[model samples]
Target: MGRRRTGEYFSLDDAIIQGQIVRVRCGACRRAANFLPEDLAAVYGGSRFALEPLFPCSKCGTTDFVRVTTYSPEIADFGRITLRRPGPKKLVQTWENETFTERSRSNYVPDGDFRF
Candidate 1:
């Protein structure tokens, strides 16, 4: 979606400067990173959306991009606080192959079962 002049709560520039939560994803490389307007205004000074044309994909050397979600700590998703205490520690074995990671809700399965 095109950047809106006024977000549900604040303007795009306000979301960038004050919210500290502007992000964009590379259309080619798909790399996503925090976009700080404080950094952008230096080289290209203009309305934030206007500067969208100047943003180049640092990963793929292309200008293609799409703005992603901008998160503000003051605003909670769907209106309520979403942060919760950590659940039980995960069983992480670094030496094992990454495919061995157990995502299923079942009890622990052996590493051999995880290999492709």
Candidate 2:
């Protein structure tokens, strides 16, 4: 028998505007903290179908991780949710060599008179 894939849960009605965080067991670690929703999207965003590994536990010396869904306000459809996990964590970690670093993280700072 195979282990069940974890399901993501979120309450939209009267729920917090910020999406909730979900924790799932790691097949290798057998622990519930194997991977986070934030991390999942980072590692597996481009695949046609999202696929994550399962381990017996969290510390099982394996790279497989559990999967769960997250409620994103940016989603277009609610019935059929689609997620595009971003790439590795280090891909955009430092702006040292990025050519567009300034433009990417820049924001307009108005003068002192623009109080709202």
Q: Which candidate ranks first by TM-score, i.e. highest?
A: 1
Assess the local accuracy of residue 11 in candidate 2 as a C-alpha lDDT between 0 and 100.
Answer: 30
Per-residue alpha-carbon lDDT of candidate 1 for residues 42-64, written as tens digits (9 for 90 to 100): 44552545325355676677675
lDDT of each: 0.51, 0.38
Question: Where does model 2 exceed 4 Å of error?
Answer: 1-18, 27-30, 34-36, 46-58, 62-116
Backbone clashes, candidate 1: 0
User: In terms of lDDT, which candidate is strongest?
Assistant: 1
- Model 2, 24-113: lDDT tens per residue? 445444555423344444444422122334223345655545553333343544444333334554423222445566676575565554
Residue 60 miss distance in model 2 (angstroms): 2.0
Give the RMSD in angstroms, all C-alphas superposed, for model 2. 14.1
Each prediction's TM-score versus the true structure: 0.40, 0.26
Task: Show model 1 residue runs off by greater than 4 Å.
Answer: 1-12, 16-18, 50-53, 74-116
